[model samples]
Target: MVEQNFTKVKEFILLGFTADLQLQRVLFLIFLIIYVFCLLGNITMIFLICADSRLHTPMYFFIGNLSFLYLWYSSLFAPKILMICITDDKSISFAGCLAQFFFAAGLDLSECYLLAAMAYDCYVAITNALLYSQAMPLRLCASLVAASYFGGFLNSTIMISKTFTLSFCDNNVIDDFFCDLPLLVKLACDVKENYQAVVCFIMASNVFTPTILILASYLFIIAAILNICSIQGHLKVFSTCGSHLTAVTLYYGSILFIYSRSSSSYALEWDKVVSVFYTVVTSVLNPLLYSLRNKDVKDALKKMLDRAKVS
Candidate 1:
């Protein structure tokens, strides 16, 4: 009977935002708009960075990589979300659900490392301005970016193997919009306390490790900024790192709130709302945050427009 039950869950039902047709329609429209804006914003950022040679620096390189990540990251869930909202078909195959979780976890983990790399880049630029070019050479930048991606996906593979190997007997309904790890863990049959502890530890490590690196990099950055004597220098330094700090805060804040809890203690409704913020809302906000607040990006856009007009 136990083995039979474990094999019965061929698919899982996702209880998305609402059951009401009217509300789902409204959400569909809203998510569609958000998805479109996310794509356009990231695409524009990527294009501007690529077209303008003047904007090609370590900072913009990281920024471009971020936009690139957003493009694929947001794409992973948004379309499926749109389909769910519109068709009211929340059924996901067992394999499909695992695939979604694997990709989502990998990309989100990658972003954490990428943000840390960006923070380090900022620290290097401020602390060693004279040697900025030499310090952040193309080869080194490439290696850091490569490591971020590799580390993220590698960790995801471990997580997926551990999580999915458990027997998800009988219960096939996920309480959140996505195949969130905690909710899936709740579905496992006869899960031991030690197993749960191990899962939570792994998840926390994924979040906290990058967070510590980011905070450490900023500590050095702050120390470097304090040496600047002028008030204008302080503001300039703050402005330079402000966008990145905001992004980090948003990403880490939501992740900590969601992942730092015992799986049994999750407020499912609240998790859904916060998930939307980091997963959907952040994608749209990042391009604007990094581009609009940036003088070089603004200049690049202006120059591109001017060139178009002349041609």
Candidate 2:
């Protein structure tokens, strides 16, 4: 098989979710509302974390970064989804597709590592109160978060460079709503197995490593909880871990389902639905997860509101 040069591939036709005019209208309205809610929710978390002195801790610091990541993460796909729903234009230029995937890859990748770091924070806070301050000092927390971003950037660069370099030859139509490595590999003119292998390797390292670390952190957390004598104390200690556990489950469950599959049996439709959950639903639910599950955020929000009412 002759390898077609990738430079000649100009654009890709994105076959969005559906073609029914009525369905498109409905989806457009639905996603528009969801996007608005997503933005508002993440932005509120960012604001509450920054403005409230009560939230000046390692947990909230990571929460703020997660909110920031969610903001840009949604930006990478929501607008395009809304646009395609509202209009007949379902095409994305080669550069546009690559750029969209690039930013998304970075955000999604960073989120994995950040969540693991957060789990470790919860473990330390619960397992050892005295050493918590020294173990997760402000500098160490900042460094961990920074390292996540840097690692994500490096991994995303490798994925984007390798995947985009493949020749997208004759089939320019992507079977999903967005440009992703798996789907892009399906369209490659040659050596798809090689592309698939490299992508799978990258995805595994980014997703599985963090996932294992998170699981390990939770094991320590559970052990600590069991050692506590009082039931109330156990519940109180476990409460802090609830929000992060839920967030990790939502983010990683969907991510692993989508990215872990081999190219030998890729299912675009199922992956598409799962992608919406992780990308759209997860972004909207993150703030709610933290605020609703944890008391600190909810109290901070209430105080903020009460102050506003007084003023």
**Per-prediction TM-score to the true structure, in the order listed:** 0.94, 0.94
Residue-by-residue lDDT tens digits, candidate 1, 156-202: 99888777777877899887678888788778886667667876676
Q: Residue 309 in model 1: shift from native, Å? A: 4.2
Which 10 consecutive residues of model 1 have the lowest summed lDDT? 1-10
Query: Which 10 residues in a row give candidate 2 its minimum summed lDDT?
Result: 259-268
Which pairs, if any, clash in model 2?
none
Top candidate on lDDT is 1
Q: What is the model-wide C-alpha lDDT for candidate 1?
A: 0.87
Candidate 2 C-alpha error for residue 147, in Å: 0.3
- Which stretches of candidate 1 lie above 4 Å from their native place? 1-5, 265-267, 309-311
lDDT of 2 by residue, 268-310 (tens): 6787888877888788998888888878889988998899999
lDDT of each: 0.87, 0.86
